[model samples]
Target: METKIFAKDQLDEAVDLLAKGELVAFPTETVYGLGAIATNEKSVKGVYAAKGRPSDNPLIVTVSDEEMIARYAKEVPERAKKLIKHFWPGPLTILLFVKPGSLPTAVTGGLDTVAFRCPDDQLTHDLIAKLGYPIVGPSANTSTKPSPTTAQHVYHDLKGKIAGIIDGGPTRVGLESTIVDLSVKTPIVLRPGEITPEEISQVLGEKVLINTGKVSDKEVPKAPGMKYRHYAPSAPVVVVDHVEDFAHIPLNAETGVMALKSELSKIDLPEENKFNLGNDLVDADHNLFGGLRYFDDKKQIKQIYVQGFDEGEESLAYMNRLNKAAAGHHFK
Candidate 1:
């Protein structure tokens, strides 16, 4: 359970363990993934057991390239092909109908579709190529917890539960890929991620369907992290409609504000306690977790007052992740 930080040379050992049906933590463009052989039902089950993930929430299959992914999917929709052409080897996961009996039931959560991605990170690609098959990789943390960015974070959450950890350093995106389901005739976005829906629409010439919320069970989801309470911290986080809502909150001497610099200046919070996460979405996206990590370190702060972003495709993915992290802590 002691997660070892494996180097490039040690990646072979990591793959060997995975091939033998043992779990290994490896890096991807989005976040570190707790991986096992996707085709091996027992190995895929280990991923669920290790992360305490539910069977109904499916796992994403990580492959080295587009061709590798084609084998698992029954048919590739035109929209999916356009996206793969434009964004493969990046932080984008496309859902396709599973080729009957090609992948184990566990990978699909018994659903008809499968989520597949070719990560941009070299370590993950190399690991997949070495293993010679797709790997079942969900974020390397317990279901509904903050996604791990580094190997240490993986160890912190999964130290005693997994077999090994391949330390690929911090993830570049620090969030999961946008999951687009192409199984339906019209493309539906099962999950929002770093790649915005607007960006996806530009490629496919159609609006992508946004998920109602992460915890909604209205329909079967195509990927992990959708059916759980996720990206949570130790303290309660409340998302407000505007800065004025801050006044009604009782100053219990344990609350702090997380907002844009412009909003932070307007608020009356003590300068020391005010958490200004950048003025715009780009910087805010980068600062989101760092702010949460800071709060985690402070420990004394009991409540986090988060401000919502204005509506736009650019802000959609960031807001989606933010809302989930807050987990029903939002105000109109």
Candidate 2:
């Protein structure tokens, strides 16, 4: 199957289809999003079918500007405003309380809060702007499958499953956005991305609470990627907790290690049993899916082992994607 790469103006047609309740796949700074009108139930439902996602999982609404955000959310908090000024048109997603008549329940999974982001990519922004409505923008792939960072990745996973795909070039972040919930009095980091928690705190002058990684009944998540198994590949992938345990990886001609920056010297695996993405967390995060695709393309590699990151803002989102990509797979 061939993927269609659409120009910015061509995206208007996809937006037209979305207004008529059709699904379209497009790129964002974080990752490619499979979009449909958020208020239209059929459009939202079509997104779920296209990606095989569960109904209970909510989708983030992508808008073109701050004004559009106000149209959906009841109140965008003061701290949220500061963060938006710094991170808007980037990969930061702010979760705010949903207004009474703003959007359909389908977009929020019946929750009173909606996850929203104004994408930095012009092509994606134009699609939402042309539609003149918030669109349900979730990573364009099957639930738990690797999120598409490039248009070809979308076609690789969702070809013939969705109506059309806008093949923008590679995503800048190559991971999902940092999801911050502003509905509460204090800003909390539900999920971290390229925008570190330190950066968020610097802007707000208040320490942002990081989710304890424990699922509690009181927690009302605003986005689909949180506390969920996501971005997994077909083969088993494991994350190593200790560099010393690198040797414990089930090594052979078929096993491969995706190592970290400082720990590369610690890895003594055979050339064929190793693939170096980069040592830096930023590089590792960006090259994650691409490396997975590389290994997946290598027929001899049957299992993949990854080196886990120490806790930090940059590490948080990287770990999130890595953990999920290796979910139901392994730990070491």
Candidate 3:
């Protein structure tokens, strides 16, 4: 199937296609999402099929606003309300007890709780509002691949598999949303994103549990991109604790290195084999996936090595994605 690229003005057409149970890839504040009407089982299944995503990996439902939560979620607790008031229309997804029979099994993965978020992007919010219902918007890429921040990335992975893609340029957050499980007594962060656990705790006037451990393969993931080795590129990625380590590591023509601009001169690799992700943490976060994709597209490069960042508040989300992309292969 030929995937059509829709402009911002053509969102009405995108909404129409979604209402007809066709998959439409659109932009969120965090990343590009492969969207399907959440209420339609067939459409929701198409998302998993198109992306080769695991059937059991639950998809997050994107809503227009806070009030729309009632249409899908069973009940909103008082703490959840506080979170919504502060973080709605941003990069934060809350896992709430879903209304029985309200959404398809394909959406919740047979779990009682459903993940929901109101994106900060106007185009996506308008698309959901105009469609008059929620849409399941997972990262618009093949399962276990780097999440697409640009529409071209989506087209490369899912061009013929999906119906259409709305090109809203690159995503601002450059990472997925922070997923908090409100279904439990104490809210636990299932997946970390732009929003930090400290921010959530400060807003709620209570401590939020941060679950940073990897989920065992035996357990079913409560959220998308949790259990799987996600955001990986075709090339093997190695994470090094310090940038200086890259100088000691032997390099060949087939190797590529992703490091900070300051560390690039220290690495022995050729200019083409080196990708400088700028100096700021935000710069690294914004270019993390794009750099991986860039090196992965180079046929000559087989091995990709990345410099690890500090685990500070801003860098936590950046490292989370990098660690997952490297598949925990870190060199001290």
Which one is best on TM-score? 3
What RMSD does model 1 have? 2.6
Best by lDDT: 3
Whole-model alpha-carbon lDDT for candidate 2: 0.80
List the RMSD of every prediction in angstroms: 2.6, 2.7, 1.2
Give one digit per residue, the lDDT tens place, for model 3 in 1-332.
88999999999999989999899999988899999989999999999999998898999999999888898889989999999999988999999999999999999888899999899999998999899999998999989988899999999999789999999999988889999999998889888888999999999998799887776877768998778888888888999887668867779999999988988878777899999887877788888888998887898998899988886776778888899999889875
Any residue pairs clashing in model 3, and if so which? none
The lDDT values for all models are 0.81, 0.80, 0.90
All candidates: TM-score: 0.89, 0.90, 0.97
Give candidate 2's error at residue 293 in angstroms: 3.2
lDDT of 2 by residue, 1-332 (tens): 33455666687677776778877898888889998888888888888888888777788998899999887788887877898898888988898899987787778888999888988888877777778888889999877788888888888888877778887889888888888888887778888788887888998899888875655455545677765677766667888877788766656788878886566656766766666768577788888877776677678777888877786555888887787788734463
Q: How would you order the candidates by lDDT, starting with the best? A: 3, 1, 2
- On residues 125-206, what C-alpha lDDT tens digit does candidate 1 reach at each position? 8899988999988889877777777787788778888889998877777778889888776777877778887788889998
Write down the worst ten-residue block by lDDT for model 2: 212-221
Clashing pairs in 1: 1-159, 1-160, 144-229
